[model samples]
Target: MRFPFTALPLLALAACTTGPDYRGPETARPATPGAQFARASGDTGPQAPAAAAWWTALNDPVLDTLETRALAANPGVAAAEARMRQARASLRSERANALPSTNASALYVHATVPGLDLNDSGDSDQSGGGSESLNFYNLGFDASWEADLWGGKRRGVEAARAQLDAAQADVADAQVSLTAEIAQAYVHLRDRQQRIALARDALARQREMLRLTEQRHAQGTASALDVERQRHLAEQADAALPPLAAERDGYLNALATLAGEAPGALDGMLAAPSKAIVPLPPAQVAVGDPAELLKRRPDVRAAERRFAAATAKIGVAEAARFPSISFMGLIGIGGTSPGDLVDFDKLAAIAMPRLSWSFLDFGRNAARVGQAEGARDEAAAHYRQAVLDALRDGEDALSRFGNGRLSVASAARSKASADRTAALTRQRFEAGAATRIQLLDAERQSLSAAQSLSQATAAMTADYIALQKALGLGWR
Candidate 1:
């Protein structure tokens, strides 16, 4: 059959699309894509960060295990994945809208007419002689398709696809955040445990010093005030234990929860204090330039995708302003007798072409188009802001990581000096050249220095995790 002349132009315009096309976010693109981060100096090398499991860089097996488990089971990550699946389903639904829909139906009707004569043929006067029973059967198919003359459905599909991309990016962003949080909590747990152990050791030594001071007093060489001073030092050391223990337990519980386990599930594995200190990240870290950061950051990518989706929605809104054309068809076979329903000669069909327009709605379509444009602009602004934030995050993380390295080094040097002083003091005391109280004071300074070192090391590792997160290196 030949196509209708009136529908020729509609088919010709079917390939035409409405509204603006998205080429990339112009506002969000960096002018200097090759610029280096200002803080990427000294300890941070000017190299692209590895896309591997960043937590494994610490070489702590427990941390690696926790990160793997958290990524697999974390509720936040699971929710993001679910949203991604939902977006994918929406995209599929939108694509299906562009195709024709068909439905099959089988209908049977039975009716009884009183005061109707079946044996009277066409004679109307004999109709009340008897009642007639009738049975009708129909087997039919119905199909309808709304032509995408202005590409509205196509635009909808485009928007849905971009939304799916955004959802996938959200999942990646969640993984990055979860990994960083788990690493931070683990570092904190180890830091607290180390501090507690140092405090306990210091308390034991202080108690021993108190006993020595009491003996000296009984030998008529030391004053009662000296014994009281030693006891006060020992008590102070003992008083510092509980808070550290509490903090250690808090971090342990946090790790367990992050791994999708109960609060105390990890207690058996992490509750015991270890003599080992918090592991330090490498001295030099690889931080790429700002250009790479924007591309790698999941939040930035998600924002860009949302902007694209919004841009496509403008097309959808613009297409809504035009008239819509649709075609519907029905094909059926029906007969009063059961055998007649199967006869090909008894078939009936209908074809309907429809047109609908909202041209009389005043400015409603215009207002909808305006609203869509406004949303597009808002998304563009958000995309630009996301780019800025990603850059700032990378720079800030780089600065902190660099400074953290210095802080750790300073603490380590202080610890070494304190240790040397304490060793010399102990020797002097053994040689009868220095007093017992002098050795105790030197040992206390050493313990304090060790604690400071532990804190600095943990902070440095935490900063490293932040830097990895900024680079978006934790997710596959």
Candidate 2:
């Protein structure tokens, strides 16, 4: 307190430190997240502004439950949280280092003189036993404090605080990725379910066609090869199911892992049916410009904090190059008996002021400063790259999402046309206006259209998830 000096206090100057103060990088700030994303608005059905829990837009309670559970219990999230706590503890330790510390200790001593012994008058006795003894007890508190004259301790605290901030951002980053993974896996699982069902339906229809073809072959209108071909088509449809079923199970297992459970633990919940609604993102998403994106993205924030920490470390190294000042004070009372240990009037006090300088070791200290500067520069580069990356991700996600919506519409149209064609072809075959080959070809077209639609829908849903992740909309 009060600069740790009293005599010649007027001669002592205020703490002056040498180091480059960090004013963030001198770069052109990008426009605030654009008023609207380049690919947002107009074509993506009814668009609405995104909320923090973007997955809730899907209107799937199952996904909501999954996201909640994953955020609450996922191992990744827990690990991130643990790291944050550690950073905070480190920061606290660093801050505490700037304060004074005191410790109490007790000392007892007994000694015998070589050729003398003390009598009633404390005089030395010689010749008989020729022994002298002394006993004393001492108890005291020792206190010491280092003056932060060069701000080295302060810089260390600053760095620790920034590190804590970085850890916080890391947790947010984990949540963002975890939520996105859950959404993507959930969408894929739903898509596979729909595809598998369609495949099964197609197989049943092909079986019927095969039976009819056999009847026709017996009646002499269909050849053996035609019946054989129908049988082959049925088998192909049957073959499609296995891969889809495998993929569905894979997604379910992934979901279980995301929720921090063993694989297949979520099977009971997911087994009910793949009715998960993979909703498209709103037509007009409000992703603020590049500035907003940079701040919102946890990785970017983490990078920025790392840069701050590095900058503060430069001050730490620079401070180390200067002289250090420390003060120690001790108070103690001692007597021949332990009962006199608490006598204040007899207490002895000592104070020490230490000044240390490594001025002779300037080269080594300079090298350390150089290392800190290099690390700061590296951290600055990382922060800049993080900003660039955030912008790139947001732009890319928006582009994919917008384009995916258009693709979904086209696929839906193709499926509707296929359905109509299959219906008309069936009626014509029944009336003898179309051959069995024509009906079968129409059914194949319908199957292809259904597959395309399912894929397009899944892609659109995935696009939404990606965009939300890029925007950092969830895990708020």
- The candidate scoring highest on TM-score is 1
Residues 1-476 of candidate 2 have per-residue lDDT tens digits of 57555744423422555567767665426754245556655653223334368788788888899999999999999999999999999999999999999999999999887777667887666755667887889998899998888778888998999999999999999999999999999989888887777777678778878888899999999999999898898888788889999999999999999999999899988773634344555555556666667667888889988998999999999998878888999988888888888777788899999999999984999999999999999999998888878878988998998888889999999999999999999999999999876797788779879988988999998988998889876765
Write down the lDDT of every candidate, Cα atoms only.
0.89, 0.83
Window of ten residues with lowest summed lDDT in model 2: 42-51
- lDDT string for model 1 (167-216, tens) is 99999999999999999999999999989888888887899899989999
Candidate 1 clashing pairs? none
Per-model TM values vs. the true structure? 0.93, 0.90
